[model samples]
Target: MTKRDIFISLALMCLWGFNFSAIKLGAMQTDPILLTALRFTFAVFPAIFFVRRPPEAIRYLIAYGIVFGLGVWGMMVWSINLGVSAGMAGLLMNMSIIPSLAIGYFLLKEHLTPYKILGAALAIAGLLASITITDGSVPLKALPLTLIAALSWSLMSFVVKQSKTKHVFAFSVWGMFFALFPLVLFVFIFNGTQPFIDLPSQLNSEVWFSILFQAYPTTLLGYWVWNRLTIKYPLSTMAPFTLLTPIFGLIGSIIFFHEDVSVLKLLAFALILSGLAISQWRPKKVEITSAKLKSECK
Candidate 1:
């Protein structure tokens, strides 16, 4: 990757990292579904003008949109509303890597190296340790919702891989539109007219700022830059940069929410980072004449 691409990738990670705090802030006043709805509503305008939809298989696109946009965000919003800490949520959501790998292996028939397996194990273990070591009691009620969010993301990743779509931002915009109805239904089923009608009219500046940041910076610009980078670089080269998101999330949590960091949590973070590194690490190559000959024949 070029230096500029690396910088863009880092910027994208930072944007995504700060999103946890943004979500947390928005949750303070806005109803979760309504907040999500408003986010998509804001996202649609720029997307409509700037992004051109890819002419690809409709099934994959619809599937990607539903899983990624509606399913993931719906569960995430509910989890946040049910009292899952944003920092913890961010950390746990990284668990999607496990499912993502599994999908690649089983669905796509991709080869999995020993290092990848070990890395996945370490990451899962670290996540478990983080949860066990928390000082405050975990909200069991929110656990299911959070897990659902992670699964939704995993599914979305696979769906995207399966999709014939060439334009990620365009697909994302359409996905948000697809999510609109389901999100409204979700809010209606859960909170009914009560939360919808009773939302605070005293909309603080912070809330609006949070919404705008999420829609424009995180969702729109972040994805745009990220998609461009992916197009320019190989997936293996680009994938490792995502590890930075959780790091950013942790820092953002500390700065914005004053989340306490215990030794155990730190250890867990280290283990997770180590696991991610292990998963991506390449072994030393030993060139062989026979291998070269076989490649030439193919």
Candidate 2:
């Protein structure tokens, strides 16, 4: 990768990192599920009409939509609303790698390496440490919800890998389009019609800004740039950069939300991140294909 590409990757990490604060801001004002609906609505509009549909079967697309949208993000936003700190949520969500590895081992007949087993153990320890928090900064109940988001994301990875979709961005747009309907249904079901009926009056510039940030920059641009980089670089080179996202997430949460980090939280962060690094480690001589990298981009 060029210096410029490295910079771009870091910048995207920051964009995604701060997105949690953005989601938190939006969730605090509007209904969480409704806020999610607004996000996918903006994500799908104009762009969805312009983008071509992916070559995958409609069932796969809809499955991607449901898992990506409601299963992953719906639970994430709701967990944040339940008082999980944005930084912690980001870290917890990355634990998806753990489940992905496990699922591959058991269901897909993949090998479970020693490094992966050790990594999983460390991450589990970190998760256990998280349960001790009583300061109310990180809600114990919300932790499980975030873990569910991680599992959903792992499932999404499988979905993307299973389907032979060549158009990454187009597939994502269509997935968002399908995701919008269920989200809207969730809003009406849980939140009632007034939020939607009064939507125009309810939206302020700050809220709109948050929604647009999450929709355009965080979701679309982030995925696009990351995918482009993955296409250009080796998977070994590009994949490691993603580990920085949760670091930036923690930083963003501290900077934007003034979140205080505890000693246990720091230990958990260290264990989880260290385990992630170990799991993602590749032998120095192995080369990976662009197709593999593309499939990994969700």
- lDDT per model, in order? 0.74, 0.76
lDDT by residue for model 1 (1-298), tens: 4677768887887778889888888886778878877777788776677767677667776776577667777778667777777678787677677676777678867677787778778878888898888765248888887788777877776666666457877877776667777777878987898776776672588888877888898877776676566545433345446656767887888999888889888998888889877876656553366677789999
Top TM-score: which candidate number?
Answer: 1
Model 1, TM vs. native: 0.87
Across 182-209, the per-residue lDDT of candidate 2 in tens digits comes to 8888877887888777677768987898
Model 1 weakest lDDT span, ten residues long:
231-240
What residue runs in model 2 are displaced by over 4 Å at the alpha carbon? Answer: 1-12, 109-111, 225-243, 282-298
Clash counts for all predictions: 0, 0
Candidate 1, position 5, lDDT: 77
Candidate 1, clashing residue pairs? none
Q: Which candidate leads the pack in lDDT?
A: 2
Which residue pairs clash within candidate 2?
none
Report residue 37 deviation for candidate 2 (angstroms): 1.1
